[model samples]
Target: MAQRSVRASLARAFLYLVLLSLLSTGIAILTLASSLRDAEAVNIAGSLRMQSYRLGYDLQGDRARLNEHLTQYNQSLRSEALLNPGRFWVPKEVRERYNAINDAWADMEHHIRQGDIAWYHDNIAGYVAQIDLFVLALQHYAERKMMQVVATSVVGFIAIFTLVFFTLRRFRHQVVAPLNKLMLASKSIERGKFAHPPLDTDLPNEIGLLARTFTRMADELQRLYRSLEDKVQQKTLSLQEANRTLEVLYSCSQALNVGTIDRHCFTQILQLVRQQEKVDYIEMLVGENWLLCEGTQQESVPWQSAAITQQDDELGQLRWQASVGSPPMPLMQSVASMLGRGLYFNQAQKHYQQLLLMQERATIARELHDSLAQVLSYLRIQLTLLKRAVPEENEPAQRIIGDFSQALNDAYRQLRELLATFRLTLQQADLPAALQEMIAPLRQQTDTTILLDCRMPTQALDAQQQVHLLQIIREAVLNAIKHAGAQEISITCTTSSTGEHTAAILDNGKGIASLSEPEGHYGLNIMHERAAQLGGRLTISRPAEGGTLIAITFRSSSSDNNDEK
Candidate 1:
């Protein structure tokens, strides 16, 4: 069936009602107009009765105006209302009764004209009765027209009422109910749920189209809502990760900013990395030394490692055990790089301390060399002149003078060694460069080859340790130069896997005659003392090939020195 819109249905219903009302109006108008003519016919028929009585009174009394009464009666009987031929308002019974009155009046007229008063008296009542019957017929006709008017009015009202009732019902079902459902759906969407049942789309109306459109729009909205939720969740996770990265970086920076970095500090930084990256275990290794480690090692799981580098120098390795899709390499590497910088700063701080100590010792050495060395040299010269002046005459005085001079000479020599020891200075932070500088003057003094190989870790030695180690090496080299009288000195420094440092000074020189110190000479004793200050063992040995080797072995001050077995 063809679909009709609400507008068309309402308009059609209104048109039907209007047509019904018009039909009723038209019928009522026709009936009322006929009723008006019926009233006039009844009045005319009633006047005939009055005229019959008046004519009867004229016959009984003087018989004067009898022809006039008869003429009036005949005119009333043939009146337009009673005798009109084609008036549908006039009933057949009224017409028949009017014709009967006319027939009775025609006989009465003959008698009255021939002076027949007794005949007129007898027929007058019968003619009035016929006139009464005519009036009753006209009344019945008017009543019937009124009945038609009432019936048309009642039918029109009933049809219009039915149309209104059914139209309202359809509107409720097709328009109002669907619109309410749409409103409810809108409310459900507002609450972030698509909970409403499906709308009816099969109706052939605007409501059906609206329902289908609303359904599609709701589906699209639901999809968009889900998408938005996912996006929001993703953004939140991104923000959280960014916050964690920033926190790790900031904390690592704080840990590195201190004056000294130790195993404890590195452990803290690694812990921070573990917390941020959510790793199982993490550790830092500088060369073979594991400086700091956090969490237990799971050898079953392969570790993800990043080089801790600064300016292309790989300072260490950072290793951790994490899942396959762990945090990106850049973040872990960034943390590793930050730790590398911390190690660099630690080395630099140690160097700075060493430099300050060397500078202080040099200052003391300068003060002593300028004042005390001049006085000691002058005294020694004066004592020598006194000895020469008294030597030929008095043996006892000469002997005493010789003893004093020898004692003075020994004291002067010991003071000079002390000055040299105090004057030891490191011009740069690098140990290799400082060692080269130390050996430069010695190299110029002899044709012997002096090779220095330093391979110690940057953080292995502190200021005091470097000072003591340098003193020990210098003393050993000087003993080779002055006493051994040999050439070809090689100084090599290395670190073991257990973080132990070893420095060897070898020279193809005459071996020492005895391990004991010579009388009034304490070079070897002082060298041993310096080694003791480093908390190390100094060993002197003659190789089978006839070279003297002096080496010191000690653990690095920076490490726990636990060797992995």
Candidate 2:
């Protein structure tokens, strides 16, 4: 059978107790009834012996009452309640002694009735001895039966007590022990300790099942609590990251809104990110130039980086080194985007200003052409007339006149060149087209062969960069033709793998051996100034192959190199 529950077990224990009590009481009652019956039989036997004595006493006392005593004795012997010893739980020896007493009484009655006093007297001692023996037998039987009842009662009590004791022990171990464990486990749960003790399945009872259920509940709670905690922590981190990103964007917006976006402003932004990111180092760059740099990397791992860019202008990249799990990539991206917009705005303003300046230059060029060209032309004509009017015999005055004329011619040429430079504009959005236009007039003016070699990205330079770059090339080409008397000039424009550009003007000419010039020699100075405006490094030198090479190397003011590591 399946093991009982605690309730059933208790019920069973009570039932066992009740049954034991009933069995013990029954044995006691049976023992008591048997003792009572034995006692009654003993009493009956005493009465019979007393009656025999009374009959003898009556005959000795008075012969007139002899028949009455005999009659009483006879009636007592015939009474079944006194003589029927077999009806009680009497011993066989008791019944046999009673029967012998009955026979002796009958014999004594006959002697008394026949008037044999001496014979009756001689047999009366044996008859009384028989009655006494019968009485002793009945007493012995009652005492023995009573003793048996006591021994049975004692044995039953011991057995019942032993059964109840073991039953209670089973309740303590199986029911009480398991219940106590469950209570302790519940207390632990209340205190937020979800780990539980092992269930004792060895006991196949309801308490064992309860323990197993509680253990499962605790394990489930631990799992759910851990899961909930993890989710909450993850959400907290996400919120923290979002708040940090918002803070960065707010600062960037403030800078942009206040029009304070400059090198110092960007440096403050880098420090701000450094404060939040907890990194070993932080640096920002536009191509290779660092705008902001802070801290130092004492570790071997490389910094993670993100590009700062707008629609086309790549402002720079932001780089930082942090430990594992502490990355501010989203914040960095926001910073990049905000800074990129600021830089784009700055570039747009510059472009707008350059356009305005170009318009003014063009207007000035037109004015110079209208006023200065006419005056220089008239002066050249007058000098020619004065030279021709001078007499050939006055050689010294003729030579002076010729020198004056020559000087006027040179001034006119320089003025024309300046006007052409000012009038120059990009008719097409390409470097080659602008170069072709700048050198087209030169080809007609000089006997030089101009070779144009151009390799560039499709979306070349901005308007301001294009203007400065073209001016530098034009100055170099003019220097090669007019100053060096070069016969062959080649213009090359190309981009490097890093997206940096180089524009070179080469000439097969009598190379100038001197890099230094006297004061107010404006040719090289003008070219150098133009290169500076383009943010290009300019170099002019006699190549080993016997030619002057003027080269300007610079990167676009926009995009970063895609292959930058």
TM-score for each prediction? 0.54, 0.42
TM-score, structure 1 vs. true:
0.54
Clashing pairs in 2: none
Q: Residue-wise lDDT of candidate 2 within 45-117, one digit each (tens)?
A: 6676677666666666777887877777777665654447566655689778867877777778787777776
Q: Which prediction has the highest TM-score against the true structure?
A: 1
Local accuracy of candidate 1 as per-residue lDDT tens digits, 273-323? 887777888888887534567777777888788999988998779988976
Which candidate number has the best lDDT? 1
Candidate 1 minimal-lDDT segment of 10 residues: 556-565
**Candidate 2 accuracy as lDDT:** 0.74
Model 1 misplacement above 4 A: 1-230, 287-303, 391-407, 497-499, 556-559, 563-565
Candidate 2 displacement at residue 517 in angstroms: 6.2
